[model samples]
Every structure is written in C-alpha cells, then in structure tokens.
Target: MQALYDVPAPAKLNLFLHVIGKRPDGYHLLESIFALIDWADTLHFERRGDGLLQRHDSEGANLPPDDLCLRAARALQQASGCGFGADIHIDKRLPAGAGMGGGSSDAASTLLALNRLWGLDWSLQKLKELGLSLGADVPFFLGGTHAFVEGIGEILHPVTLPEQRFAVVKPAASIATKEIFSSSLLAMSKSVAIVAGFPAHNSSENKTVDVTRYLDGFGKNDLQKAAEAASDDVVQALELLETKFGNSRMTGSGSAVFARVVQENGKSDPAMATMLQEAIPAGWQGRICRSLEHHPLKGWARD
Candidate 1:
C-alpha cells in the first residue's frame, strides 16, 4: 500500500505512579499502571519514493519543528537501513504536557505505520527496541495494551482491567517533566512487592477483574506535590475534579488529573460530561474517557 490513513495514536493515563528509586544514570525508577484511553491523535502516512521524511500538522497546530513523529521516522529509517521515506500528517488532539503520553504515542504510531508502509515487516520486539530510543513511554505504546509498567517505563506486563470510564481534566497551564522530577518536594516510595500484590491476568481473557480491590488505596503520583507547587493550575485542576468526583489523582506527572467515574446500575453516569463541562474552568480541557482493552493499532507489527 502507498498510503495509510486515519491511523490512531491514543493517549494513556497513569492510574498510579510511584517513584521507587533513582537509577545511577539519573533516570527515576518508577512503577505504574499505564492505561490506554480513547482520547487519541490521528495520523496519515503516504509513502515517498524520493527518500525524504516529512511531517505535517493540522492547521494552527504549530507543532515543534523536530517533533517525535519525524524523530521516530528518521530513527526507524537509520536503524533498518531502509531507503524509503514517508510524509506523516498528524491530526493533533491530545494536549501537550498533560502527562498523558501524547507525543510518545504519536511517535510509536509513526514507527508502526512506517514499518508497514515501508514493508520492513519488522517484529514487535524490534519496533519496541527502536521505540525506546525515542522515549521511555514509546515502548509502552508499542506494547499495545494496558500494562503494569516498571523500570524507567521499558518493562511491560499486560494486565486485564475491567472496562471503565474516567473523567479527565487538563488545565491551561503545563508542567515540564524535568521540572516535576527535579523539584525538592519529589518523594520516593519504598519499593513495594508489586509482583505479590499485582494480579497477573491475561488481556486476551474475557473475564472481569475487580481492579478497584487493588487500586482503591494504591500508590499515587509521587510527582504531584512538586507539580502542584510549580503550577497553581495543577492545584486547581486537582481540586476541581476531586470536589466533583469525590476523589482525584494526578496522572503521570502533572497538569492533568483524573477521577474514576462511578457507574450507576452498570451504566456510565450520563451527567458526568455535563458536570465536567460546568466544573472545569475556562481555557481548560475535559473529557469523559473510556479505558481501552488494547490500542487501536494493536498487532500492526508482527509479534
């Protein structure tokens, strides 16, 4: 095929993030569950025989000149020694600096799409290895399912989570990942017995698991305190969601916080969206997002 259209690159929510320790290399060791959400960015790819990698963004998007999509495509080309090229267009939807892994997801999608567009037919493992070079979270996106992530975000253990909805909010302000991690307020948690507490359930199974039993009082984003201190908007977003939903937590790092939407009679509360729309302040973004069992492009690459 010469072109691939309407390929999706979904965002992720850090159901819970903990800073266990710091690696000698200055990377923080983390343990968290990265849950895919339906909120996504769309990408289109057209094969280019002229051996040139290009990226186009939606009008008024004003993306960075050297965004992850271009970086991912170049990296793949160099790694595979492929002479082919592609023109990638991004329909940007996810917010930046929301701690939602938007850019990483885009990069992962680019790699997966280019692999097919170029007919490289690379294995999933190969793509993931190349993906890690792009960013820590890129590998998780390539993993293609909700996963229990560890070890600076490279390790992935696919876990089954019951279908659920979340109320997600992103404030007008943004916080840098480095700023959150470098803050003195950042706290580290004692390494817990993740293997013992985290149940190992296959994502392929149709059975339901009571995720709340483990997540109810589980770990939190250790970076939230630092982020709140950095941006008053973070504090506002957290309070806004917590006040309305009865509980809220910052995902990944900061600026975006989410709360689990309680279902009524086995159906999502219809009023959740209205509540979010009214409660969130002007210039902020909110959505009622459903958890995904797997990424939309799952299995795009050979296993």
Candidate 2:
C-alpha cells in the first residue's frame, strides 16, 4: 500500500493508577488498568521513497519540533534499515498534557502503519520493544486491548472488561507530567495483590471478569493528589464531574478527570450524557465516551 488514510489513535483512561515504587533511574513503577476509549485523534500516512520523514497537523496546530510520531518513524527506519519513509498527518483531536496518552497513541499508530506501508513485516514484539523507547504508554496502545499495566507501563496483561461508558472532562489548563511526579504530595502506595486474581495470563481461561466494584471503591488514581497540588484545574475538573456523576477521579497524571456513567438496566442513559456535556465550562472539553474492545488497528503488524 502506498498510503494509509484515517488511522485512529484512541485515547485511554487509567481506570485506576497506583504508584508502587521508584526505580533507580527515577522512574516511578506503577500499576494501572488502562481502558481504551472512543475519543481519539486521527492520523494519515503517505509513503516516501526518499527515506525522509515528515509530520503535518491537519488542524494547523503548532506541534513540537521532534514529536513522537517523527521519532517513531525514524526509530523504525533505523531499526529495519528500510529505505522508505512517510509523511504523517495528525488530526489533533486529543488535548496535550491531559494524561490521556494522546502522543503515545499517535506514536504507536505511526509504528504500526509504517511497518505495513514500508513492507518491513516486523513482528509485533519487535515493534513493541522499539515503542517502549519512545514512551512507557506506547506499548499499551500497540498491545491493542484493554490491559492491566505494570512496570512503568511496559508490562501488559490483556483483560476483557464489560462494555462501559464514561463522562470525561479536560480543563483549559494543562499539567506537566514532570510537575506532578515532582510534587511533595506524591507518595508510594502500598502494594496490593490486584493482579493475582486476574485471568489475563491464561488465554484459555475466561477473561471476562467484573471489576466494577473494585473501580468504584477499592482503587484510586495515586497521581490525583500530586496533580491537584500542581494544578487547580485538576481539582475543579474532579469537583465538577463528581458533583454531576457522584463519583470522579483524575486519570493518569492530571488536568483531566472522568466519572463512570452508570448504566440503567444494561443501557446507557442519554439524558445523563447530555447533562454532563452541557455542564462542562466553555473553555474546557468534555465527552461521553464508550470503552473500546480493541484498537481499530489491532492486527496491523504481525504477532
């Protein structure tokens, strides 16, 4: 294929996050359940025979000098010694610094697309190893399923979650991941055996486990406190969602918060979704998103 159009890079919600410990390299080891959501950014790729990578923002938004997409392309090119290159265009739907894994997802999709576009035929494991060099969350997007993530987000255990909906809101302001991690408010959470009960390791076993009760009460985003300390927008977003939905928590690092949209008799309530969307402030962004079973680009690369 000479070009791949309208590839999706979906955002994720950390159903719950806990900082378990710190690595010698200053990276925080974390445990979280990352759920792919329908909210996403769209990307397009066109092949280049001259082996020169380029990126374009479809919305004409300013992007970083060396964005993750370009980095991923370059990495793949170098690793495979492929003479082909790509011109990547991003739709820029997801917000930056919202802890939604937008950049990571974009990078992962670039890897998947270029792998096929350039005819490299690299295995999924090889792509994942390269993806980890770009960011911890990149591998999860490449994994293509809702997962129980650990070890700074590289280790993944795919799980099956019941279909659910969420009301997600992002404030006008953004919080730096560094700022949240550096805050004095950040603390290591006590280790728990949440993974022991999971059937993710065995494909033959039934993977559909109900963890709604755990999400509702047992787990919490450990980064929320630190993020709130760094940005008041985080606090406001949480309060706004909590007041509307009765329970809310900050996802990932912060500036975005979400609450589970309670289903009534196995169906989502449209009125609740409309009310939540209307309640968001003018400068902020909010969406009622349904969880995704797998990434749209799941089988792009060989397993």
Candidate 3:
C-alpha cells in the first residue's frame, strides 16, 4: 500500500538579522528572530515501491538539476537505506531568493514527510543531523517553531513572541545570498546578547532593548547596505516601502523588506494585511502575513 504524504514548507521573516561577526570559515555569526508566516509552499510525497527518488513539480524547474529537494530526498534515502523511493511534488508559493527560506523550508519538509512515508521514525535529533547538511536554516524549519537563531543559523532556541502582523514586499529582482555575504560593503561587527522577555515583558528595560526597539535603534542589516549598493531596483523598492511604513526594514539579505505593524491592541490586523497586499508597487509582490506561533501542519506530523 502506498501512503500519500503532504506537508507545508512555510516561509519565514527574519524579524531582524544582525551580522555580529564573520568567522574564519567565511560563515557569519548572526543574531535574528525568525518567525514563520502563514504563506507556505505545499509538498506532496508518494512512496514508490522501487528505490528511486523522483520529483514531480515545476516550481523549481529552473533551479539547478541538483536542487535542495532532490538532494534532501537522496540524502534521506542513503541514510535510511530504505528499499522504497518517493515521487515528490512541490507547489511553490513563496518567491525565490527573497530571503524567505523557501528552498531550505522545502528541504526540511521533504526530510520530515519522507521520514514518515517511509516509516523511518527518526528522532528529531537524528532528523536535524541530516537536515543541517541541507542548509543552515533547514533545522529551524524542521524544529517547527518560532525561534531565536544564532551561530551560522544552526543553533535554534524557541522564543515566545506576541502574535504580530507584517507587511512584506519582495522586489522584482532576486538578490543572491552569496553575493551579499561576499560584498565588501557588508557590516560585519555587532555585539551579541540574548533578547530576553521579548514582547511579553514591556518594561522600560524590555521596551528599551526589545526586538522592535533594537531594530528601530540599530537600523541595520549587514547585507542590506551591500545589497542596495549592488542593485538599484532593490534600493528603490526598499525606499518606497520605508516611505509607506515608518518601521520598515529588510527581512534577510536583500530584495525583500518588511514593516512591523501590529494593531493598537497588539493583535493581528487583517485589514492591514489586505491593505499591504493591495499597495504593492506595479513591479513588486507584497503580502500581509501574520506571524505564526506554531506551524500550521504540525498536527499532520503526528500521524
């Protein structure tokens, strides 16, 4: 009997990303609060009796033949030595290279869904070991919770943040992560500290050093300066968003900027989401998404 498996690969917002330092290996130490969004790409997997991995979606057609999805499936198969293979399908909704963690999320979904479909029954720790090989952000998506991430983005600790609204805008252009990281203009120095008692502790100290406050005070994305310097379209799009939303900042490396705009009551705002979506510039894509406290399909994983 072939069991059908479907899972969601949710996009993420780097509520804010700070490059604290660069490592000898060229990987940058980062401090970021990553929140999952409602917008997600769906992946479906079907087990094949024969031991051969296959993909059935066109979302990543133009990506290199050896994309993360295929690589993930192959890696899982190799590790488990499962006699069965999977035919994978992806419905890509998130934009590519917008710093939304699309590819990494897809890879994490592949590892998780296939584990159950093949009856691998691997523990979360084991799953993470395999997932990290796919990408730094893969483990966070696999962990399936809002997180405070650090150390080249592999170390993840769940953090409680108030449910919030974000107006996300992706420029027509895609800024390559590698280019931004390697750019000479990137800011590579920042101090490290745990953002304790985020939105819940609205005390004067908390208010002074809260994630939103830190972001508003710092006005930094190590990659943003480099990315904007590298492309004019990105700068134009970011400028327009900042003009509309006063608290606007780039989400990840480049090309996608987000504005934090929760309601007066500190609740999610559907109207704001609608307005943000409608207000996208002629050549850009935008959405108003709520920060997800938990992954939508977490119940499915229990099956």
Candidate 4:
C-alpha cells in the first residue's frame, strides 16, 4: 500500500589502505580514506502490504539467496517494529569481490531507504550503528560523508574531499582482503607516518590532515604489491594504468586499479579517460567516475 523508491548503492574506492596492525580477533587495523564514486549498483524497494521481503534482480544472479540486503531489511524491521515489508529489486552494476564494497553499499542503502519508507525515521547515528553490524564499509556509506576511517573502520571523521575524476579498471580476478592481510609478504610492521600533505606514498594521516593538500599529493596502497604478486594480471593492469595516466593505484586489496585524470583537454592533451578506456586490456573492465564528497543518502538523512 506504500510507494516504492529506488535507492543507489554506490561503489567506493579506497584512496589508500594501510594495515597498521592485526587485532586479536584477526581483523586488521586499517587506516584509509574511502571515497565514493559515481558508479553504483541500484536497489528498488516496494513496500508489501503482506509484510514479505522479496528480492528480484536483473544483474546479480550469482549472489546467495540469503544476502545482506534482505538481512538489513529484516534488521530494520526488528529494530523499528515498523510492521511493514517490501519487495527489494537490485540492479547490480559493480563487480563482486573487487573491493568496491558493492554488496555492503546495497545493504546500507536498503537500511537507509527502508528506515524512511517504513516511517521509522531513525537518526543517522542510529542507522550507522545498525549498518556497522552488516559490514565494515556499510557504516561509512550510512554516514554518507567522506571519512578518515580507523579501528577496523568503525571510527569515522567526516571529511570534504576535492572534486576529482577517476578512471577505474578491474582485472578479471578477485583478491580476498583477508587473504592479503594474512599474507607474510603483506607490509605490517611499517611505521605510521605523520603526513602533513598526503599519505607517505603508503601511510595513513590523522583527521587534522588537510583535504586539499592530500589531493595534490599522491597516496599509495600498501597492500597493492602483495596483491599484485598473487595475481600477475593485477600487476599488468596497474602497469597499463600508470603508463597511461601517471597517477594510478590499486583500491583496497584489489583487482581494481584506478588512475586520477583530468576530464578536460587543455595544452593539447588527450582526455585521460578517453585514452584509458580505449586502451583497457581485453580481459579487464574499466570505467570513469567522479569522486563525491558526499553520498546520495545525505539528502535522505533525518538530520
């Protein structure tokens, strides 16, 4: 009897991921600035008068039936006692296991949208608390702001990132973050840097770090060399992006590599985006996305 709404589950690119230490529970302590991109998977929520949560999809047949999206809806229902249900449809665009946080974003969006659609009217802090139980990255998406994240990513300091365009390429394989973190070759004992401008080629900065200064400075992925060593295709793709765009880095423990590029052509330069897409390897996927200082859900927040 209620209207259906389409919610976006945007993909994230970890500007840099630094594994500082391993927790006793095996979750690694990480420091990274997670940036949301324009590319996203979308979820549609249609309230069911019958109180049934149904999911139909045009893109993601591979995800298991008991997915986080449904779980999130159930979580909201139990948390709010809204006495409402919905049919959720997913239009998945981002690749799975590519470290883009596609599923987690979907779960976050589902919780946020349903909180509104079901008339629960929960606060952002409450939504983020619920989202954290779903996934590490889910809290960040629920916060709907760019953040300097720490403590296995529960701690967040909202940040304003400069508007920049990115060219992202995903190799044909997925690198598990857990596997990479547990690898002996992964850099663990490296001293954290007190970065004034940007991450020290591969370090994390505190909340006081200036956002503009960091943008001009190049950040590095500490797990990249290790992940690339596990997959030669990742190494090859990184090389292609760097050779073409000059500022390329792997996002998270990644098969996805992204490059910063200028959209406009001045001084007789080829559009970096146009060049990268045309040169994408035969077995790889690529897209151009503009960085966002805020997530779409910011508009929906109860404030």
TM of each candidate vs. truth: 0.92, 0.92, 0.86, 0.89
Error of 1 at 229 (Å): 0.8
Task: Sort the candidates on TM-score, descending order.
Answer: 1, 2, 4, 3
User: Mind giving the per-residue lDDT tens digits that candidate 2 earns over 50-144?
Assistant: 99998888755567979998999999999999998888888988988888999999999999998989988999999999999999999999989
1-303, model 3: which lDDT tens digit per residue? 448877888999887677887789888888777889987888989998998888777645456567898899999999988899888887878888789898899888888888888888887778888999889998888877787677788877676666777778888888888998888898865544534444221121212223434444453566788988888877776776677666777778867888776455543466666666676767677887778878764543442
Better of 1 and 4 by TM-score: 1
Report per-prediction Cα RMSD to one decimal.
3.5, 3.1, 5.1, 3.6
Pairs with steric clashes in candidate 2: none
What local distance difference test score does each model get?
0.86, 0.85, 0.76, 0.79
- Which 10-residue window of candidate 1 scores lowest in summed lDDT? 200-209
Candidates 1 and 4, the one with greater lDDT: 1
Evaluated against the true structure, the overall lDDT of model 2 is 0.85
Clashing pairs for model 4 are none
Worst 10 residues of 2 by lDDT: 199-208
Evaluate residue 22 in candidate 4 and report its C-alpha lDDT on the 0 to 100 scale: 74
How do the candidates rank by lDDT, highest first?
Answer: 1, 2, 4, 3
For candidate 1, write residues 108-151 as lDDT tens digits: 99999899999999999999999998999999999888887778
Winner on lDDT between 1 and 2 is 1
Clashing pairs in 1: none
Error of 4 at 8 (Å): 1.3
Model 1 TM-score (2 dp)? 0.92
- What overall lDDT, based on C-alpha atoms, would model 1 receive against the true structure? 0.86
